[model samples]
Target: MPDRIFLIHGYVEDPTIFDKLVPLLPPADYVPVNLADEFLRWQPINSVDARQVAQYLTNQYKITAEDTVIGHSMGGWIGIHIKQLTGAAVVQISTWTDQEKIKFPTHNLSVLRFFLKTGLTQSRFLTSFFLKQYPFDESTELYAHLLDNANKMSRLYIWQQLQTLFAKVSPLTVQPDLRIHARADNIVAPPDETFVEVPGDHFSLVFHAELVAEPIRTIIGNRPITDIW
Candidate 1:
């Protein structure tokens, strides 16, 4: 049995966001897990979520070290934890380390806090307006989707979990994870990623298939599967 490729999306994002990249690779097995549920319920802050996700898939589908996992933003954080549990090869995209928070701007952090406290659903315009001000260069399509389906409180809970996790990460534990970020990204900052440099902002960074697939292909030690379309 071939190892599987588990793709995790960021906060307020759905699995379809990975549609493009999923087809570009070989057919091992692909699972799209929704991190947020109806009412936008975010999972409790625990590294165990990652472990559980890995184990759940492994039981349902055979997974091993040869298998690859890719995650974006908060999803990347989950992927890291999953790696700890599974020792599977990982792909970290537009992600941050526990230590990387030190580099984020204070004002942005303030915006994050405000966004979380107010819950974005009630103030969609205001939330989108604030994110536009940031340095993100990705397509707003996904954000627009999130705005419609997301529960602000759920988003806040996940954000808080991420912040807490980042604060406590030890420096020695920061391993050589393959991180790919957009050069113009403002969400997590391109510099925070270890293997940086790709096109588009945080949202588009994942939405645009071509921009992300090449680097991901390299990291997974697989040759690029040329697009048929």
Candidate 2:
């Protein structure tokens, strides 16, 4: 049997975001989870929640160590926390690094405010309207997928997660980290303090599978995973 991997989605996203990448991945089983549901279940986000989620998903699939974790954006942060919690090798894409707030103050504040307000609303139209911020060009298949997911994601759950996120003392911190970022990214900039350069911005970085797959495969092959915490 192939090893197992847990692919966690970023804020305001669902598991389908990894559809393209998941298939291209090596033979390992991939379990994707909705971030909103996770946040809903775990009131205060921390390493413990991440560990529980990882263990639950792995158990559901009957997977063991030798699996890796792949996450993007907020998911990337979750990946690190999972690593700390589970002692898994992690491949973080377009990850928000510790230097982010200091490097891009305005962008960070804007995103925070948007998350704060968006997370509190439960409207489908409002949620759809908000996800339009992702850099999906009109003609791509990815655009259609985003549109479909806009309707599927739970607005109330997203809002609640954001509310909890707002109450967080510090969203990003340094510890057992592996991260990737686009050098030209404006959403999370300066690309330093535990981030590697990828091809595009946040959305593109997540969808770009080839760039991500190798790193993930390498990590999985290198070490055994564990439910550390």
Candidate 3:
């Protein structure tokens, strides 16, 4: 009965985004939830999406209070909702606590929203061009594959997610068990509210999986699975 480790990915992303980091963690039942799927396509808010994720986990894996959830970016917000639902231990990575901080000025999210509403988000070139500005390692095979996946995301789905991001999020009532943030992340402001600082930008932190996973492993500790039962 090892603690179930659930990985929740961010906007326009799927579970595969965690491919690099998942393998680096201690052995346990690992579950990766994909929020950018048809089932979650119509979700109006993160809380609704998180409830569906919680239901999926409960039905499929019997997820309980003992489970541990790790979330990245938008996923981190969902992790907070999951904590409300299941009382699971939460770990947030490169996530913003303040709604204002999540809105990066350079990204021009409002313009992107307009494009999405006007059905301009279908342009492959536009999507590629927009994503190119992000500080991901283009040389890595993982990022290349992730880019391909991102290109395929539906415009409406992306718009729905963006709406959730822009909506007023409730303040975190429970402190996350652990918080990991990148020192040079441009998308989200650096954590002034206590967090573990790792080298690299937002994407690079995930790119360098070992650097991110080591600290998580240390927090997870060496307790045997059966002991939790």
Candidate 4:
């Protein structure tokens, strides 16, 4: 068997987001880590942050230098810390570096925490009415499951993650070996330079896995994928 390749999904997304991309990957034991399931279970000192979460994962999974971590969006941000712990190579997709500034809709984290902690973010009735009222495009479609996942997705999970992500704490200084991003992503717009430009947007991993997989294949090299779970 070749080295393990852990696939980390982004916020509010399950391992299913990788369904399309997994088949095209190079030979390795492709393992998808449910950031929600694992990260939510970890109790942290101070507040939850990427490094702490990564350490939890390192201890639980016995991550080592031979492994590779492939993370999408926010998952990619967390993957850097995994690299810090295990010396594992990292592949970041649709993610940003520390220098990149993001403009969140709500600057008030307290109010944002209120909704996520109260399960208001998973409200189907409110979501349905809002979709009807605003009619956001495909990106909104991407988050449609939020309406159905109220019971499955915990308020604590979302709230705690937001706290970790939004905390002024700087993400670890580790840089990924490869940074692949879609040029047309609406949700997390790709920077003009640096990234190996690919076709489509944030959802391209679903619609254009072939294109996304091209770069990944080269990085994965000659590893023979014996099995995946």
Question: Which has the greatest TM-score?
Answer: 4
**lDDT per model vs. reference:** 0.59, 0.55, 0.68, 0.72
Encode model 2's per-residue lDDT on 101-201: one tens digit a residue: 32323334346556446653344565466456555353245544654665565555544434322333334333434566667554555444645566755
Q: How accurate locally is residue 63 in candidate 4, as Cα lDDT from 0 to 100?
A: 88
| Best lDDT among the predictions, by candidate number | 4
- Shift of residue 33 alpha carbon in model 2, Å: 1.3
In candidate 2, the residue pairs with backbone N, CA or C atoms under 3 Å apart (3 or more residues apart, or in different chains) clash, namely 119-159
TM-score of 2: 0.63
User: Candidate 3's residue-wise lDDT over 1-229, tens digit each?
Assistant: 6678888887767776688887788777777877665345434444333445445545555667788888888777777667766778778888865666674543456786777777666566765665677664533455456557655777656665665566544455776778888877766776678988887766544567788888788767743344332
Per-residue lDDT, model 2, residue 203, is 62
Task: Write down the TM-score of every candidate.
Answer: 0.68, 0.63, 0.77, 0.82
Ranking by TM-score: 4, 3, 1, 2
Poorest 10 consecutive residues by lDDT, candidate 1 = 220-229
CA RMSD, predictions in order: 5.5, 6.2, 4.0, 3.5
Of 2 and 3, which scores higher on lDDT?
A: 3
